[model samples]
Target: MTATLMTGTDLAAEMVAKAADRARALQERTGVQPCLATVLVGDDPASATYVRMKQNRSKKAGIGSRSVVLPAETTTEDLVAELTKLSEDPAVHGILLQHPVPAQIDERAAFEAIDPAKDVDGVTTRSFGAMAFGEPGFRSATPGGIMRLLEAYDVPIAGAHAVVIGRSPILGKPVGMLLLASNATVTYTHSRTTDLPAIVRTADIVVAAVGRANFLQGDWLKPGAVVVDAGYNEGNVGDVDFAAAAEVASLITPVPGGVGPMTIALLLEQAVDAAEAQTA
Candidate 1:
């Protein structure tokens, strides 16, 4: 049987529209506009484009966005200072430090600079702790988006065996935690994992986030497994080979049109939530 398509593009559009209305209502209720501050260092073209896309989406959602661009040589101390300023700004409701900052900078330090209340992207140590413990807090945008998509499609999570590849701080680790919180038995694997295919084949749900071009093949999937490809590599390829996976998976998400749209939409939605919470 051909796999059912789980397209995030249409879902994200619907989410953004609701977020826009929430933003408008928050501003009307408290005279406080939702504002997101995006920080980027070292002018990576892809990172710049991502930041710009977020800013554009924020505007369309009726939320305000501020961008902080730093030179490639920016020091860790300086980057932290910049993020700190945004964190303390009462008007700024959310803080997002674009990942892969300059090599010399301490990315973790910069991420920690944002206050927990404004950590809408959910990249802070505090946010991770909250997720691990199943506490209420902002979730990392990508993982949160994946969960939303799963819920929207009514993919059964409770008691399902979920195999999550990759162990990155925000993406893999937290996503696995989220699935576990939803009662899915989670098995997290990485590059060093031996017999990766064997592990993946046992999963009823799969989240491919290895960050390589078509690294996870389609045939490794268990027939009728629900697949979420969270990887977007060069040439518009995802971690899982979409063509091959679609033929086998009971449900599959496509590259570019899948997880990509959901990330920004969730970010905007969380920003509105932060604004409303902070004002209250």
Candidate 2:
């Protein structure tokens, strides 16, 4: 069956509109605006574009945004200090540090510096713990967006055999946990896995987040499986070979128009949520 596409662009637009209303209501009631602060270390063009997209979306949603661009040679301590400052600022409701920081910088340390209360992008230890424990807390934007897209498409998550490829803390690990919380049998695979294709062929839901281009082939998918490609590689290729996978899978999320828009949508939603919680 040619897979029915799960388009994130449409859903993201709806979610963003709701976030805008929420932002307006919060501003009207408490006179406090929801604000997100993005910290960028180094001058990575892709990261810069991602940050700009977020900022532009925030403006449309009525969420204020501030950017802190640091040199590529920034130290971990300096980056952490900047994030901490944003955490402590009453005006800032959320903090996001663009990923793939300089080699010398400790990314996790910088992530931890964002206060749990303002961790709208949800990259901190606290947020992960909350997600793992199924507690009420923010989620990393991309994974959260992936889950929302699945639900929006009415995919049956419970009891599904889900194979999540990759082990990244923010993407694969957390997405697996979220799926487990939804009652899916989750298996996480990495580069070291023996015969990865064999494992993927058994899954009813496949989440490809391994950061490689066309790593998962269409032949690996179980017929009628639900495919979610979360990879954003250079040249706009995803971990899964979308053209091939779509030919077999019953449902699939396309690259660029799939997970990307939903990510910013959730971030804006969480920023508004954080602001409302802070004011309440």
Model 1 alpha-carbon drift over 4 Å, by segment:
none
Cα displacement (Å) at residue 143, model 2 = 0.8
**Candidate 2 lDDT tens digits, 1-280:** 4999988999999999999999999999999989999888889999999899899999989999999999999998899889889999999999888898989988888899999999988899899999889999999889999999999999999999999999898999999989999999999999899999999999999999999999899999999999999999999988889999999999999998999899999999999999999899
lDDT of each: 0.93, 0.93
Off by over 4 Å in 2: none
Superposition TM-score, candidate 1 onto the true structure? 0.98
Predicted candidate 1 versus true structure: per-residue lDDT over 141-218, tens digit per residue: 999999999999999999999999999998999999999999999999998999999999999999999999898888
The window of 10 residues in a row where model 1 has the poorest summed lDDT is: 100-109
lDDT of 2: 0.93
